[model samples]
Target: MFVRIVKMGFQPDKIDAFFENFEANKNQIRNFEGCLFLELYRDKNNTNQFFTYSYWEDEAALENYRKSDLFLKVWGETKVWFNQKPEAWSVDKVVSLE
Candidate 1:
């Protein structure tokens, strides 16, 4: 499995709108091919900071999703609210307690 993490910092006033847009597109993103799991997280001390954690079957699968229309539509709108460039990482599991 491939794990993808994206950390984003949004303009303070745009946080709520960003979450609303994310919520609206969540299902569509989660349903994409090879998307095993998807989740959103908020920084404990920073309301305008968020992270997206997702699992895919592999890099190619993730790439396919990234290139899909669903991603284009969501990302196109989401980028407008960012206060800074988002950070992303793709990793493979080394160990899992569960």
Candidate 2:
């Protein structure tokens, strides 16, 4: 499995718009092929900061999503709302309890 994490910092005023965009596409993204999980998280001390956590079957699945037209539209609009450059990581589990 492959996991992807993205840490995003949004312009304070544009946070709502960012949520709207995520709400609009979250389901579609989760339902995409090879996607096994999806989640969103907010920073404890920073309301405008958020992170997306998702699991894919493999790197190719994640890459396919990145190249999809939906991604193009969503990311294009989403990046404009950022107050700082977003950070992303793709990784595989090293160990698991269960």
Candidate 3:
């Protein structure tokens, strides 16, 4: 499986709007092919910092989702709210305790 993580820093005032946009389109994103799981995480100490953690069947599957309209729509709107460029990483599972 491929594990993908994306960390985003949002402008304080734009946080609510960003979440609204995400809630509106999250289902469509989760329904994409080869998507095994999807979730959102926020830093307790820093509310404006959020992270998206997803599991995909493979890198190609993740890439396919990235190329889809669902991604474009969500990202296009989300980008405007960012205080800084987001960071993303993809990695293979080494081991899982659970």
Candidate 4:
């Protein structure tokens, strides 16, 4: 499995809107094909900062989702609330205890 982590910084005034949007769409995202797992996290020091951590079957699977209409809609709505450009990383797991 591979992991995709996205770091997002939202505008302070738009945080609530972003939260609601994520809550509303998270289920569909989690259920998308190739998605093995999904999680959302907030930065300890900055409430406006968040991260989406997800696991996919492989690169192709990730690409499929990235190209899907669902992504287009979700990302379209989400990007407008961003205080800065989002950053993402795709990587392979090297080791895990559990």
Best model number under lDDT:
4
TM-score, predicted candidate 1 vs. hidden true structure: 0.96
Over 4 Å off, model 1: none
Backbone clashes, candidate 1 = 0
TM-score of each model, in listed order: 0.96, 0.95, 0.96, 0.97
Q: Give the worst 10-residue stretch by lDDT in candidate 2.
A: 89-98
Scored against the true structure, residue 96 in model 2 reaches a CA lDDT of 75
Candidate 2 lands at a TM-score of 0.95
As for TM-score, the candidate ahead, 2 or 4, is 4
> How displaced is residue 24 in candidate 2, in Å?
0.9
Model 4 scores a C-alpha lDDT of 0.95
Tens digits of lDDT, candidate 1, 1-98: 98999999999999888989988999988989899999999999988899999999999999999899889988999999999999999999788896
Model 1 C-alpha lDDT versus the unseen true structure: 0.92
Model 1, position 12: C-alpha lDDT score: 96
Tens digit per residue, CA lDDT, model 2, 14-41: 9999999999999999999989999999
Note each model's CA RMSD in angstroms. Answer: 0.8, 1.0, 0.8, 0.6
lDDT by residue for model 4 over 1-98, one digit each (tens)?
99999999999999999989999999999999999999999999999999999999999999999999999999999999999989999999999896
Ordered by lDDT, highest first, the candidates read 4, 2, 3, 1
Question: 3 in model 3: Cα distance from truth in Å?
Answer: 0.4
Residue-level error in angstroms, candidate 3, position 34: 1.0
